[model samples]
Target: MFVKYCTTLFAGIWLLFIADIAHAQQPLPDKIAANKAKDWQTYRQASIADSKMAVYFRALTSSELEAINSAKSNGQSKANSKLIEIKSELTVESSIAGFLLFLQDYDKIPNWLDNANGSQLIEQITPSHNIFRIQFSAIWPVSPREMLIESRYWQDRQGNVHIKVEDASDHYTSHKNHIAISIIKAHWLIEPLPNDKLYIQYRVIANANGKMPSWLANKVALRSSWRTLKNINQQLPNSDWQYQKLANILEYQELIQEPTSGTNEQTKDIMPSNNAELN
Candidate 1:
């Protein structure tokens, strides 16, 4: 009786160990599908907001002459002069799903971005809400050491994600010698595309605190936006490859349990190699 009990106990332990290994290797299909759906929705809203903002900005530009004339007649000398110095604004559009995938996998801002030296996560208030601090330095001439920036992300009632970035420190002096001199506002609309793709559009309105030249500031903003998109383009293909590999593994596991000839060998031969191909 003791020998029989020992055999049964050993068999039970062996079965449990095999079950754990199988569970670890399996991907949660339901979770992955839900995540992809959520990402698609985020990108869709961003696209609509981007279109509206573009029309509004263009109208503002066309009315610039009237604005300048009104300021001059009102004895607003400073405002009148500033109107002529206004630089062209920058805009960037991308796939929302791709950007989110890039962010989730690559959290380090400076790694994929150019002219971004120091970056750190400041706080995590909740799963969806987090604060990030970043420092940007000049690429050419290397004038200032760095510009300190703090950013926050939150979701609105419509399930849209909004991100805001602001200057956090007063290392450099503004006209009033106050920290309020350096403030920037940016908005992003993230949407999803068919076939696991995303659509992301970004709009930025910056108030440079009279320290940086308007033209130079605009260039910096444009460069930063391009760098972010370039990084996403580079990172997305790798993600697709990973997903395909997981799917293949799941298919193989299901097929092995069925009675089949050596047909599986032929299928394996036709499988494509996992190469890093970016679109």
Candidate 2:
């Protein structure tokens, strides 16, 4: 035959390209231990503002203060006082599965997420839940904006992890020339301190609904949540996202069974011992 059919069609395309690179390097089955376990509450012990950022208050239930004084006496909406909950705290050395795989990598989130020009991952509702989208880059005379969040992360039983973002923009479908961040509430606690530290806490609140002004949307959400939590704690001590190898993240399975005594420590810990003071 034609050279044995071209060597069996190049050995079946080289065994399907090594089985698609072993199914893209496997290891993504953690559905938060069958979900159900969120009741996260705690944000009333302020004092984190040596420029580290804070002002994430909560407490409004008299029918939400009579629907924000009946929408400020029917002027309609100020978008709930421009909803601006900002928060930040730190203590790094990262490893809660390398900062939750650098916050589940949504296309590497515009590299470091400062103004986040773009990001995507429309849906993956499992390996710890997902449904994302991000875009934002207009800062003068305010305009460009986007968000379709619906994140979810979990892991408790002492070894904390949280995550939890909202506002799914009615489950997808967006983008008609930006502008659509009606409201979004966010959170992301990591906590797992003691030696190989990691105690960061982040918070957010949004409402760039349209006529942006609540003191310029809380001064651009407090300098963009303090430079996006100081650029995710200075990019989590980049050792390629600090050894990104998540397998149900038990501290990366004990740092891959003690990688030579956690390799000389230091992943940028200490320096944000309570930082959120802007009420």
| Residue range with the least summed lDDT across 10 consecutive positions in model 1 | 38-47
lDDT of 1 by residue, 1-279 (tens): 999999998898767644542342212121122112222111111122222211111112324435434533221122211211111111223333334434433246667666566555555554333445445554333233333445444322222334444555443222222222233334555443344343455554444333454334433444444445555455444544334322111132234364555434423432324211200
lDDT of 2 at 277: 22
lDDT of 2 by residue, 1-279 (tens): 999999998898767644542342222212222122232322223333222323243322334334544544221244442243456676656678777777778778776777778888887857777888899887555678888888666554344667777777765666876776744456788777656667787776566666765545554555455556666666765637677655554563454454443331322121122223211
- Lowest summed lDDT over 10 consecutive residues: which window, candidate 2? 25-34
Residue 276 of model 2, lDDT score? 34
Q: Whole-model Cα lDDT per candidate?
A: 0.38, 0.58
RMSD per candidate (Å) reads 27.1, 19.1
- Candidate 2 clashing pairs, residues 3+ apart or interchain: 48-275, 48-276, 53-276, 54-276
Winning candidate number (TM-score)? 1
lDDT of 1: 0.38
